[model samples]
Every structure is written in C-alpha cells, then in structure tokens.
Target: MATEKLRQANTGIRSFWWWLQCIVSLLLTALLVMDRAEWIDVPGLQRLEWQAYDWRVRSTLDGQSDSSLAIIDIDERSLFEIGQWPWPRTTVAALIESLFTTYDADLLGVDIVFAEPEASHWQRHWENLVEEYPSLASLPPPTDGDQVLANTLSNYPVVLGYYFQSSVQAGDPPVIGQLPEQAHLTTDSLLSLPEPQRYTANLAILQNGALSAGFFDNPLVDADGVFRRVPMLQRWQGELYPGLPLAMLLALLGQPQIDPVIGEGSGVDQLEALDVGGFQIPVDADGSALVPWYGPRGHFEYISAADILEGRIEPGSLKGKILILGASAPGLMDLRSTPVGAVYPGPEINLGLLAGMLHQSFKAQPPWIQGFDLVNLCALGLIIVVIFPRLNAPLLMAVSGTLLLAAVGGNVWAWHQGWVLPVAGLVVLLLAQTLWHLSMNLLRETQQKRWVAEWFGQYVPPQLVKSMVESGESFGLEGEERELTVLFSDVRDFTAFSELLSPSELTRVMNRLLTPLTGAIHQHKGTIDKYMGDAVMAFWGAPLRDMKHADHAIEASFEMLAALERINREFVAEGKPTLAMGVGLNSGPMSVGNMGSGFRMAYTVMGDNVNLGSRLEGLTKVYGVSLIVSEATAKQAPDWCYRRLDQVRVKGRRAPLWILEPLGRWSTLSQERCTWHAAFETALDHYQAANFESAAQAFKELGEEDLTTQIYLARSEYFLKTPPPQNWDGVWMHTDK
Candidate 1:
C-alpha cells in the first residue's frame, strides 16, 4: 500500500512534467508558424532562407540560355584596341551601325548610357578654334559629336538604357531623356510600387532619335548582396517606366497588349502577373521576377566590340539575334553578384532576363506563398508532437531524420516546379521539436531514476528498481497520459453478502476474496489503483511503463476469475454463499496520476475510457459474462479469443463503441466454445437485423440456461411485439453506468 502511494505521487509529477514539455513544443511551433505567415518577421531568417534557395538553384542548373540572345561585350581587349574610356562618338555610332547593318541584328539595347554629350577629336579641335576665335561659337562648334551619334540612332533599331538612383550627389547629372509614352502602364492606385528619386537618362536628342529607352537600374538586391531578381517597372513622380529587359521584350513582341493582373488579398491591389502580347509572366507583389539563370558566366556567346569595329567579326554571328552592348572590363564596374558567381557580368544578367522572356520561363515568389509555408510548418509540428511522444529513441531519430529529408526534398521539387517556397522555416521547426523531445527524454529519465532510488529502493525489490533505472524507465508515481489497459472487478450481489455478515466478518471475507486477486494483478505487472468495498480497480502501463499493457491486463483478469473460483469453493465449504466475480478490461489513452485532497491523495487513472471500464464491469450482470473487454484491448491481444458483445453508446459518450467478451487465450479455448461463439455471433446478428423469431430459435439452440442468450431471447420477443423503426442502426444506448 505504501509503495502504491509513492508510485502515485511520482506518476503525477512525471505526467505534469511531460505535458509542460508539450506546451513548450506547441509554443515554439506557433512562433515559427507566425513567422512563416508573415505576422511576425524573424531577423536573419530571410537571409538564411535565400542562402538555402541559392544552393538549390546553383546545384540544379541545366543547359545554357536560348541561342538567340548574345552579348556585345566591350571587354579589356576592346578598351586596349580602341583606346581608353569615352571613345569618339562616331566610333560608338559605328559600333551601333555595324550591329544593325553589317551583322543584321534584329534589335540592339545599349546598356551604356549617353547621359553626357561626347566630344570627338574634330569637335575638341573645333572647341580650341572657338577659344582662338569668338566667331566659332556661332559656327555650332563644327557640328558637335553628340549630333552625329544622335543621327545614327534615329535610323537604327537602337533602344538606349539608363539607370535610376535613390539619392543624389552634388555633381549628379540631371534627368536628361524624354521618356516615351505607353512604354509601361499601371493602374491608378499603385501605392506600393518602388519609386526612384532621380534618374540618369540619355541626352534628349539621343532619346528622341532612338526606337525607345529603358532604365537599366535593378533595385531588388537581396540581403545576401546577390542580384536574384529585377524590378519589371519603377515609379518616378507617379509615372511608370519599363525596365531594360522589359523594353527589349516589348520590342521583340511588338509591344503586344500589356495588361496587369490583380492578385487576391485585402483592400490592397497588387500586381500578380503581366500579360504581354498574350504571354502571361508571373511577378511578385513588388513586381519583381526571379532571374531565370540559364547557367554561369560564358553561358551566352559574346562578340568583342573591337572585333566588330575592326570588321573582323564573322558573318551571321549577330544575325537576327538581340544584342546587349555592355562593358565586361574590370574598370567598367558592371560586374554583379548573382547565383552563378559573385563577379558575373551585368550584361549577362540582362541577357538572361531577355532569354527567359523569349522562352516564357520564369520563377516567381508571389505573396500567397506565405500561406503555403505556414500550413507546412503547422502540419509538421502536429505530426512531430503526436508521434514523438510514443516512439523509442532509435525510432524517434529515424522518423525525424525521414521528415527532415522529406522537407528538403519536397522543397527542392517545388523549386524545380517553379515555386519559390521559404523552406527554412519548416526545417527550423522540425529541428526544434526533435531537439526538445530528445532533451526532455534525457531530463525525464534522469529525474525518474533519482526519484525511484531515493523513495522506492527500500519498498520495491532492488533488482526491480535497478532494472527500471538502468533501462531508463520512469518508475516515479507521477501521473502521465499513456495508452494503457484498465481493469475493474466486482463481486456479484455484494450488498446482500455484506448484510448477512457482521462488520468484522465482512472485512475478513472481503480480505479473503481480495488477497489472491491482488496477487494475480501484481504478478502480471499491474498497479492496484484503489479498492471500493467489494470492487477493485487496477491498471497496466503506469508506475512502470509496459508495452504489453493490454496483454498483461488480460492475463490478470483470467487469473482473478480463477482465484475467485477457489475463494468461492472455500466459502461454500464454510457454509457461506459463494460469490461470483465479473471483470472488465479496456485500453485507451488515460490520464494516470496521484489525485485527491492533500489529506488523502490516491494514485489513480482517470479518463472517459477509464469510466467506460467501470461501466463495463456493471454491465457484466446484464450480459451474464464473467469477463468483458473493449475492442481496443481485444485488438492489442489478438491471440485471445473473444465474442462480440454489443455496440453500445456508453453513458456520457455520444459515439457507440464495441465491447467483446474475452473468453481465454486462443490456445486455451475449447473447440466447443469456438462453435458456440460462431453460433452466438450469428444469433446476435439476426437479432440486430430484427429477425426476432429466427434469432430466438438460434439462441435456444446455443443454450437455454445461458443468461446472455436468454436476455437476447427476451429482447427478441419484446421487439417482435412492437417493431423498431427501420432507421434504427441497432446501437444500444445505455443511460446509466
């Protein structure tokens, strides 16, 4: 009795401690879920997520960009062969002329901006003559060099490029170009669009002469200092301007039918996709598209401007291809950080975008993706919390490992499918849950061992305590929730038996009956919960955890019945009335703890299922059964033979549950009992089907004196006299326990 009390106390502590860990795990998962949902942003998480994405992109790179896109690189050789920076305006004009006329290029986008007027040798000489003669100023400085380049641009398919800046310096140039109308369009309420403070554009004359112009500025540098995406449009003083790549695409498609597709959300209107010439291109809420990298540097063919100038370029090299003229020389400072390399050339970036537009290949991270990420975090948390508690060390490790791999593999698969997901959040949540479980397991086992050694070493057998401690079994009587088997047993007609004896004699008789029963339960590793007069309640899988809890409870029930028979035989010999015992067993999740007032605490199991076990014990007389068990227990110990009792809605629960009569282990069942079981099931089936007369006949054939069979026979007669409704599903709802 003392050992049992101590066990109850320890079990209560253990259960409380475990639930505390669960609460912590839940809170952690919620935090991560909130982060994923964008309700709360975690610092550094975005960068980490981008880093993970970068690795996936780098590893999964396929073939190079489309063959039609090429770069007209102004490399170091060009600088060396054609003299230093700011070459003659006619030389620049000559390069543009050769691309269209000599190479037969369909389109030419000048990544280099002509923001300032150029001064050729003749023009510089004219300026000197003007200094010598004041009359030269009225001579127009010998037809300035910029005018010559402007004339060249007016006849060709040249689309000039410029950049936008957020801040202005003292000597910063003014906005020079005449931005074209209908270059880009947006709805009136573009409140969240990126707006630039100032822009460096081509000279007004140069812009007017070109086919069109676009901003080469990319304002979407990621936290990792990598250029992953480019803004499709930028706002300047409430006016929308197209990006360079977008301008080129528009040119390619003849500027076909541009339309903004609104996204789904609250009052805010965000652009989700852009339809250009019947081709739909996806973009983020900020109107940026991921740079669809074909591969690393040198992925596209580059022809030297020096080679084009010297007329040494091969024929058909730039024929019918879109050419991007941007510098690749280190001094030019056009190198950019991209997924392919830290020092990738800027021209290749723009070319990759053009290639992606041509091929209709784009990767986008829309605003709705946040919801998917949140759902993933929540789902993984739920699985971890419910499953981790029931697993052994190795199994927990294996399952968590599998989940980690699955998260990564699923994320990569989604990325390849053109979905940009923030997968780091899922990985972080899983890791946190696993680490919490492992640490709590260690702490719980350590505390349980110490607790058991201090309080239970003297009461419990030394070897028992040692084995429990060494095996990391929690032997403390702290209550915890577990899938356990509970048993309830009572003596039939105990009220009448008690009245026939004096109080002392009743006590003696009760002890005589309970002594062997208690021994049977203890021998099967069951903990005696409490004794209520002529009844006893016990449970398995607590005080000491047991995986075979259901089987142990079943064995104990059989032993208790056998013990009661011997006790009845002894009572009969003493001229006292023999007592019959009915045992009930059930298995399910139950809360086991030390519960009671401070003055009188008892270690006990409590749950709806535990109450169901007691209710089953009460129903034993109604069914005329010596032993009854719930389907849950019967399922765990399949080697035991059972008879389907009834589908009953136990008192308090609305759903119906199946009860079975646990006859004996399969090896112990007689062939006659098996035949009876089959016949009994058939009769029960007929009775439930409302074939009352047939069921009655079958029951009479099974046994005339069998209490359960007779009860069914009586019910069949009553139901036949007043037929039940057709919709009745045969579930017997019991109102009393």
Candidate 2:
C-alpha cells in the first residue's frame, strides 16, 4: 500500500511539472519571436562589443604584422613640393619615368583617375621633348601630344586605369578596345559592329597607350552605408570588366589571356585556370577573384611622393616592383572609410591585389563550402534533438553550453582560415534548442512543486516544501557550496528594548536597521540564511561559489559596523536610542541544503559546525569585542591581521576554542594604543604564569579602550580576591551563564 501511494504521488508530481513547463515554454517562445522581430530594442552599442570580438579573433589568427603592399603616398608634402593638386600630366609622366628608370619597378599601377585632358602647353612640351630626343620619341606618344605619349606607352608595358560608368547617356557610343587575339571572346570575333556596347569614353586620352586596361571600381556596401567588401568584377554591356586589383594581377602576370567556360544549363560560369608564365591564376564567376584584404585599413606600404620627386629616394627602388600611386594626403579627396578605421584607407582594392601577389591568397567560394555548411547545420541540429530529450536538467544545460561554445569555436576557426561560414544560422539553432529545453524543464518543476505541497503541506514551510517536491531531493539541493565564512550578528540588549515598544513599533524599528544590514550583506555576495528575533545568520560561498568568501565576509562585517555608526547618528537626531551590534564569524565545512519534511522545508544548515558558529556569536559579549572570529577563520584570512583574545570552552563543547578580534584600521592606530596593546600582551603572559601582582600592574597601565586590558584586569582581580589553591591551572572559568 505504501509503495502504491509513493508511485501515485510521483505520477501527480510529474504531471504538474509538465504543465508548468508548457507555460514557461510558451512564454519563452513569445520572447524569442519578439526579439527576432526586433520589437525589443537591443542597444546599438552592442555592435561595438561584437566588433571587439571580431577583432580579437582576427588578431589571434593573423599574427601582428603589417602587410608588404607599399603605398606611394601623394601626401601634403608631395603636393607642396609638386606644385598643388592635379600637377601637369608631364609631372605625372616624370614621376612614372623616375619610378621605372630609377627604381627598376616591375609594374606601375596608377590609382589616380585621369578623366580629363592635359593643358595644351604641357602637351606641347611633351611633343618638343619627343622631337628633341629620339629615345623620347621612342617613348609612347600622348594621344593629344604633338608627339603622342602613346608612343612611349607602347614601347614599355603599361596598364591604364578607368572606372565603369553605370549611368546611361544618350548621343554617344561607348568606347571599347580591340580584344587581343590571345584574349578569349565569348562570341565570334568581329572587328567592328554597329550593335551598341555598354561603356563610356575614357576621360584621359591614352597619350602613351596602355598594353592592358582594367576598371578601378570598388563596389562594397554595408548595412549602415559603409564599405566592407570590394567586388572584383561587374557586368557592363554584356561583358565582365575586372576591378583594379584584377587588372593589376593580370598586368603583373604578363597580360595573361583569360578563357571562360560556360557550364551547360548549370548557369555557372567557370574560368579556365590560366598559367601566367609559371604562376597559376584562379578566377571565380564573372571572371574575377575575391581580393584578400589583409585587414580593414593601412596594410599597405607607403612612400611619400615628395621623396620620389625631390631625389630623396633612389630611382632604382621601383625596379621590378609593382608600384601603385595613390593619395594618403588628408586634403586629397581619395580618402575612404573602412571597417577597421575611419581614416583614409587608401584604396583597399589595390591593397587586395598587392596581397594576392605577395601571398597568393586568392578568395573563392568553392562549391564544396556550401556542402560543408549544410552538413554542419544538419549535424548540429541532430545532436541537439537527440541530447535534449534524454538528459536531466543540469546535464542538459551543461551539454547545451558546451555545444554552443564548440560551434562558435568552429565558426571562428573556419573564418580565420579564410572560409566564411554562416555564424547567424548556428546562433539561431543554439537559441532554439536552449529555449525548447527550458520550456520543458519549467513545466516539470511546476508539477513537482504541486505534488510536494499536497504530500507535506502541514509539516513544512510552503516555500521549502515546494522546493523539495520540485527538485525531488530530500537533503541535497540544486546549488553549490564552498568554504564559506559565516557571520552571525545580534543586538546586545533586545529583550529590555523590545519591552518599551508595541509589536508594530518594534517591527518598524527592526526593519530600518535590517534594511541597511541586508543591503550590505548582498553587496558582498553573502546570503541571509535566517533571522532570529534580534540576530541575523548569514553565509558566504553558496548558490554561487566565490573563492574570495573569507575576504568578502570580513569586508561586509566591517561595512556593517560602519553603517551602524551612521544609523546611530540618525537615531540620535530622532531622539531614539542608538544601537550597537556584535558580529561573530567562523569558516568551516557544513552541510548546506533543504531541511524539514516535504510539505514544509527550509534551506538551512544543520551540524555541530553551525552550533559552534552561533556559540562564537555569544562569545563576542564575553570578550567585549565588536567583532570576533574563530581561529579557523583567522587562519584563512591572511590579508587581515588579528589579535588573539582568550581560549575558552563554551557551554557544550569539551575542547577549548581560540577567540580573536580583527585589528581595525591598523594603519591609523595611535602610537598610544599600540603601546597599550603591548602592555596588555605582557599582562596576559604574566597572568598565565600566575604572577598576579605583575599582571595587575601591567593591566592597570592599559587604557579603558583596550579590549584585552579589561579581560586581564578581571583575571587579576579574581586571583587577588581569592588566591587559587596550589596546582590550580591558569585557565579562567566563566561564572556567568
């Protein structure tokens, strides 16, 4: 019959828990939906924190080192030295010639946009130079120069930079260059066609004609109108035009021909891997590769344009080097905002190209990455589903947290290794799984509480009884414990004080004092275990384990003492009697859990250890000490200095225990007090040795404020009043209860 009753009781408990979980689950679902819809405004400042996390991950993956891409800075110094903005094309041509002839640069790529013609005077000077010198004539002719600089461009390999004009204009045909025989054409070759191609005229006449041409457009858009990624290729007039980086790569690779393979009905355009001499180049859809930007900004090397113009740098420095000319000057309009910085980022597209050349780190979203992502998501989902149903609440929570961390770590690793995994999807999955488990757990716990209350409603506190039934544990509660320092504090004369006020008046007064005291306890992470009529029992290092429990408890005790002083001043002004309290602290192991029967229970500790702690609180009165602690607590608190009082056997304990007082404000102690303490210690030594006269004299010298002074004086007076019989030990017996 008893077994049957127990089984029925458990069944009812489970049912109640299930119902509670259902309600909690519904509430959680609502919250999740609201959050997803952004009905709740999560602070925008959180994005900065997220950015910090991203930076940490990036820093960890990429060693703290600058990139090798050098920037040829057209700084303010260059502007002042080179005669202001838009220095004549001849000056630009000189800058290029100096880099090529003196620096022996391998490739020269201009980041500047030459969208307009040079002045006629500058054009004529270039023509005169070409005519005066045959070698200058050998140089590519300028398209408008009397002798076009295009002649010089043709003699030496050069790549012209231009931007793609998406805007359509009427009455003019777009200019396009003839495709070299080696370059692949999507359609049959035709020298000229009437059909309009989508392109715009180049602003700068290619006086010195370029061997190859590339578009210098960076097309990246962010949620807040910021640029984070640069598109390498964009479609125009039914043809793919490569970005600046791609154009540079091609030029550096000896103007390699590009062959594109169109997959039949797959709608996937693939580039045939090409060999530029010995180097292999990979391109993605639209015949472009993602530029591997090392970071958000300033990853490229920069050289001041003044250094090149004023002969500060050797001209040979540019030899065999792919030199990019861009402005880093603040006054120049070339500055761009990027993810890593607000300052001018130079040109990230150019930086990406330089990075690609140095490390050969090309970006491509291969077909396999999509497959990997799908597999990862499905596997994660399966794991959550299988584990969520079988595990207990605590275990379920632990596993969920672990799995979430693992998933996040995996994503970070993939991203650091140049793979862009979908982080948002994994985060959503984890949230869903956690919410599902929480809903079920809440339902189960509620049902258990109801069953518990029904079984033991008459025997235990309702709160305790509910907790026992829900948790399904009689002794062990779902909590943690550590070596906590327990403190018990009580008013000195509550009985006499209470007799003067009615019950309501007494309660109000008690609450005023307890309010500040409780606030102090919580501030130090100590939980109030229980409260007697005039005493408070609280403990540290449970529910949440803090390694600094001893320190925290001691600090809280001192804070309470200070708060009482404030309270006393207020009470004095209000014509109420001031209050004083004695606090006792002890640190040791004690069984902390739910106690009492199922219907009514309490989260309390019960053991000899707890009794000893209470006894210590009572001992505080005997020693006339504001705060007293046991030897065990004093030993653990190395940071605090304490003076030992007396050793005494309390009412029940057979063994004697050492008592101590904290040395308050040791740094500020007056020299007189220090000397008095020395005298008190001497008296204590003499008293233990049965030298009553010497002990009495030493004790007499101590001031009234010295705590040990009174204890010593009392001992001496007692011995003098009734000299101890022979063989009587120095130990003093307490005559008072």
Question: Which candidate number maximizes TM-score?
Answer: 1
Off by over 4 Å in 2: 1-57, 60-69, 119-152, 167-204, 259-289, 368-375, 378-396, 432-454, 457-737
lDDT (Cα, tens digit) per residue for candidate 1, span 123-235 = 67787888899886886545566888899999888888988886778987777655654454545354255787788888888888888877887887986789998888888
How many clashes in candidate 2? 52
Best by lDDT: 1
Clash counts for all predictions: 10, 52
Q: Give every collision pair in model 1.
A: 7-477, 10-477, 10-478, 11-477, 11-478, 11-479, 12-477, 12-478, 12-479, 13-478
Q: Which ten residues in a row have the lowest lDDT in candidate 1?
A: 455-464
lDDT by residue (tens digit), candidate 2, 296-411: 55556678878987789965655565667788777777776554556644554466555664565654444344446556656666666555645557777898889888887886
lDDT (Cα) of model 2: 0.62
At residue 180, give the lDDT of candidate 2. 19
TM-score of each: 0.63, 0.50
